[model samples]
Target chain A: MSVDQFLQYLISGITQGSIYALVALGFTIIYAVTRVINFAQGEFVMLGGMLSFLLISSFGIPLIPSLILAVLFTAIIGAIIYLLAIRTAKKASVVSLIIITIGVSIFIRGFTREFLGVDSVRPPFFTGDESLTIFGALIRPQALWIIGTTIVVTIILHLFLSRTMMGNALKASAISTRAAAMVGIDSRVMALTAFVIAAVIGSIGGAVMAPLVLTSYNVGVMLGLKGFVSASIGGFKSPIISVIGGITIGVIESLAVGINWGPFTSSYKDAIAIVALLIILLIRSGRLALEERAD
Target chain B: MFGFVKNKWIYFLVGALLAVMVLIPFDWFMGKYNTLLIFIGLNTMVTVGLCLLMGYTGQVSLGQAAYYGIGAYISAILSKTYGVNPWLAMLIAAIVTGAFAYGIGYLIFRLKGNYLAMATLGLGLIIWILFRQLSEITGGPDGMGGIPYLSIGGFGFYTTFKRYYLVWFFCLALLLISQNIVRSRTGRALRAIHGSEDAAESIGINVAQFKVKIFALSAVFASIAGSLFVHHLRFVSPQPFGFLASVKLVVMAVIGGLASIWGAIFGAATTNILSDELLLGFGELDTIVYGLILMLVMIFMPQGLFVKLKEIIVQWRSKTTQKV
Candidate 1:
């Protein structure tokens, strides 16, 4: 492909990647604190999109206030799930906790379907009817919004974790819960905080991407799995790596689709993410083994 | 002596229940819709296998449907493309599916917990994508049709009643085999692994070998069910074995009470029938209902319907004894 065509694909991929990064950040935040993979993280995104759709279309709210309200609403729901399901299964086995989260995901999916009705709803774009042409590649103004918002969120998160006492406590709990507790940190509160932060970021992601993907009840599963895969690919170790991983996946997928390899390429786009996940995971495992042997 | 009587009586009761189920189509419920019940019976076969792998072995698989799809496609291709006998084609499908499962299990068994789940999920999705993309072989998204009906004893089983009987027989056979497996030494090993893999390993259980065996066994069951479904419907489509369908299979195992062999059948039948009834009326909201049921069941009754039933029965017996 030409430079312009490649740039066009790259820009679009970055836009999609930002959303995945936001979602992956949510997964990372929750996992870091609770040691539980919050499978319902993706549903929070769906809730954000669906709520935004409702606020803008039905209630005639402005985009900024609607976005705020949606994010807050999703955060509350995430906190409630943490309280009801995750807390009750705290002492249970890891498998039990995983099942509980899976259960929570299903419950949210069902509730959304019932509340939103059967049809898909679209949220109004952050930017109104504006497209930017850069180096012979056209980019939507909303794409910039997605990318910008992701960067802002990442910076804010970095500050929150580094500069704030509560953030440090949360990180302390993640690193060593017993040590954090001995130092007077409330691990429970930290977990709840992580859930809230994750939920808000996920909701923001959902609101931003709704215009591009449309808001549907069942969108959570694919989004959640992709986000989880992104987190894993980045070693689930650092937020910066997570964002890079998400964007890389999005760009590769978009280019794969753009190139049009064969007859079933379009349908296999979703499968590409899964295959990438498997390859990355196996490679990571192999590397871990090699390092162990070296030691 | 009482224990012996109870064991024999349990077998007798199970046999009687199967006999009654087999005779249901021949009775007044011979409607075309009873054929749907037969399909449910086929699903129960696959679900039982899933319960064994997921429930007893404590290994989550999202690729049960892949095996099911493989079996259906294999049977369809064999029967349609090569003019193979239907019975032989199904047998071949089961074996091929088992072999494929062994290969996949070898790779996936290395990962544990969420990683394993994701890996299986990816495998299912890959198979589904292949099924959709490979039009020349799988007929693409539209699905492969024109599969000939299965027959035995020089008589074609074209009618719903005959097909019902055919599927019922297989289901019964599978149930017996699954029950035997679950009550055997291998079953104990699986349960041990589920309880504590480290402990199971220290105690001389070859954890990987047990996992691989159960996975292959589960795949075989799923494959047989798929073969039955294709032979009955005379069509095989990728949609029936997608990621969503695999999730539904897992849901069935969980909802039905995973530890029991019969739970799979019960879960599959209830969910499948409920989905059919609700989806016809409520449109896409049926998915919501499915999700809600799964969530509620896991939250409130993680032990599942079978365990709940057992609890109730125990309570009832205690109350009766106290009254006496």
Candidate 2:
């Protein structure tokens, strides 16, 4: 690829990666605390975009306030999901828990489609749609917003986990719920907090990225799967690794479009993510066997 | 023979099945419920295998659709394009699907619980994408058609009436074989694994091998169902054979009481009716109801709707006996 083409692909890849990172962060948080993959994480992202669109265009709210409200509303929905679905079925098996989350995802998508219509909608861009020419490659200001927000969120998450008492307690609960409880940390509360925080991050990602890729109700299904793939790349452990996985997937997908074999095109682009998921899972299983042998 | 009633329930079920088979040739039975019965048969074929896997082996698969699609597409492509016999095509598809399942089962069965589910889900999605993307072969999203039907001698199973009987014949035979397995050593080993994999392992059971075998068996079952379905519809598409279809198969297994072989019949019949009759009107809203049903059943009665209903029937029967 030429320099300009590489830069163009690079810019779009990062832009997509930022969204994946946010969704992966959500997946990581929930899995870390509850050992449950909140499959509805991407739905929160969808809600962020859809709710913002509703607020700004139909509900007559300004752009800035609508964005904040949309994120907050989605987080509240996340909390409700935790309280209603997850809390009541505490003793359920692993299979049931996964099904419950999938059910919740479908329910959200169903309602969104019923209420919001199936059309793709985008919020007004944060900065006007002015394309900047850099080394003969065009870049949108919204791309910068996405990249900047991801960096800011990553740093904030790092400081919160390492420095703040609540964050540390959350981390502690994730490590050892029994020990944390002995230290007077309520694991239940911590679990709920994880969902809320994850939802907030996901919704922010959705709302911000909306202007770039138009949002729809069914968008969550693919996005959520991609995010799950990304988090799995980290083995659902480190935040930084998850972010890298997200970016890698993003770049691979964009590059799939740039380089074309006659048969494989953008149509099979999503398969790249699915392929990545399978490869990561196979690698993990292999590592698991090696560790067991070592043990 | 008169004194030998090892299981009264089995006798009753056998009698009922016989009656249905006899009545199926009649217009009264075949005219109104022909397609419905065909779908129920197809679903039962898949769900029974799932029962053996989930109910007996205690593993979950959210990607049965991948195998189902494989069976359908393989049969469709071979019979339609290459002039292969439909029956032969189906047999080849089942074997191919089973082998595919065994190969992936090695990589996936190593991961327990949620990770395993994710792996299967990815596998299912990948196949669905291939169905849509490989346009030259699969006809892309529009799917492939003009597939020939299975036949015996010179008599083709083309009509809904003939197909219904043929489908149910296979479905019932599979059910019986599965139930027989549940009584045999292999079935006992499966239950032992489900009770506790580690305990089963310590007792000299080959856990990995058993799990992979059951996974492959379930894939074969799903493949058979897919073949029957495509031949029945005379077209094969990626739409029906996707993640949601796999989920629906699981739902059938769950609602039918996963542990019981007969429950697959009840679950498939009820769910097919719900989708065919109820969803035909509401369209997109069917998902909302389907999701609610899945959550409600899993939460309130994890043992499944069929099992709970059986319990109630037994309770009421005991009360009547007390009156006597």
Candidate 3:
């Protein structure tokens, strides 16, 4: 392939990758704090997108305010979910928590269908009708927004987690709940904060990506599953690693579709992210076992 | 006296109820729609297997529908292409699905919790995709048709009423087997593992073996149900065995009460029938309604409807004794 084609694909990959990264960050934050993988995290993204579409298209709200409203609404919803469904199952087993989260996800998905209707909704792009041509490849203005937003969000998150006391307390709780509690950090509040942050980021992802891929009630399942896969590929260790994993998977997937491996190409594209995740996990576990044996 | 009446008479009443169910086809009032109950019976078979895995073994499989699809496709292809009898095709499907489950269980059951769930979810998605994409062989999205109806003693059971009895027979047989397994020593091992895997391992239980075995057993049941479903419907599609179907099965098992055999049947019937009714009348909102039910059940009735019923019964009995 030409360098220009490859660059175009890379740019497209990075745009999709930014969305995945945001969702993955949401998953990681929730997992880090609560030690519970919120299965409904993807639904928050769907809600954001659908709500943005409704606010912008239906209500004629400005794009920026609609996006902000979508993010805020999703954050509140995440906190409400934790308070209502997850709190009761706090002492329950991880299996129960997983089931409850799945239930919550389904409930949200169902509620979205009821609220938004079954049709895919698209919001007007914030960047307007502008396309930039570089090396004979056209790039949408919103693609730049996605990439720019991802970097800005990452920096803000780093600052929030490091420079702020509540952020440090959240990190401390993630590390050791007992120790954090001893230090007078309320782990419950920290968890809620993580949920709020994650939801906001996830909503931002949904709002940005909604124009690229139309927003529907069922979109969360696929996005959430992919985000989870990205987190897993990064070993769920660091947010930076999670973003890298998301971008890597996204680029590879885009390339697979671009290359067009005959009839199997479309099928292979869907399977690629999952296959990469499986291989990474297998290799990681193998290395862990070897290290254990050496020890 | 109440305990004796409840325990002893309930069994007889259940038997009579089942017998009446079986005899419904002979009566003139039964119609073609009564055959839907056979599908319910097949669902019960699969759900019972799922209940054992999820409830007793404490392992969640989102790939039960994969096994079901495998059985359906295998049996359908075998009977259609090779001209194998439906009965023999079903048997082969069960064995193939069981063996496939064994291989997958070894690889996947190694991971616990959400990891296992995700892995199995991937597996199910792969199968569903394969069924859709391999259009040349599996007929793609249009699905395969002309599947032969099951036969016994020179009688072709193709009608809905006839298939109802056939499916009901298999359901009862499977239920009996499931109940027996649940009451056996192996059941105890599974429960122990479910309660706490680390504790079960400490007590000398072969945790891996029990898990793989139950998983395989569940696959067998699901495969058999799939085979029967294909035979009855005479058409097989990927949509019915997709990831959503697997999720629906899990939801049924949970809503009906996991680990209870009768609860599995009740759950399958209730959720399936309710969904069908809601969807037929209410359009897309049915999914939302179903989701609401699932969330409400998990939040308020984590132990499930069966457990709740048992609690109420116990309370009623105590109240009656106080009056006495």
TM-score of each: 0.93, 0.95, 0.94
What would the DockQ be for model 2? Answer: 0.58
Model 1's chain B yields a TM-score of: 0.95
Q: How well is each residue in A2-65 modelled by candidate 3, as lDDT tens digits?
A: 8888888888988888888888999899888887888888998898899999999999898888
Query: Could you tell me the lDDT of residue A144 within candidate 3?
Result: 83
- For candidate 1, write residues B1-324 as lDDT tens digits: 867977998999979986778667865654556766887888889889988887887888867899999999999999998999989999999999999999888877777666777788778878988898888888999998899999887899998888888888898799889989889998888899998787999999999889988899999999999999999899988998986788788778877887878877788787877778546666555555656666556667777876788789979987997999
Q: Where is the poorest 10-residue window by lDDT in model 3 chain A?
A: A286-295
Q: In model 1, what lDDT does residue B125 have? A: 79
CA error at residue A157 for candidate 1, angstroms: 0.9
The residue pairs in collision within model 1 are none
- Model 2, span B1-324: residue lDDT tens: 633653786799889978977687568656678888899999999999988988898888888878889999999998898989888999999999999999989778987776777888888888899999888999999998888788889999978888888998889888998989899999999999988887999999999999999999889998999899889998988998887788788778888987889999999988898889767776567667667777788788888899999999979987997999
Chain B alone: TM-score in each candidate?
A: 0.95, 0.95, 0.95
Clashes of 3: 0
After superposition, candidate 3 runs with Cα above 4 Å error = A262-264, A285-295, B1-7, B26-33
Tell me, by lDDT, which candidate is best: 2
| Segments in model 1 whose C-alpha atoms lie over 4 Å from true places | A117-121, A262-264, A286-295, B29-33, B278-280
* Shift of residue B171 alpha carbon in model 1, Å: 1.3
For all candidates in order, state the fraction of native interface contacts they contain. Answer: 0.41, 0.51, 0.36
Candidate with best DockQ = 2
Cα displacement (Å) at residue A19, model 2: 1.1
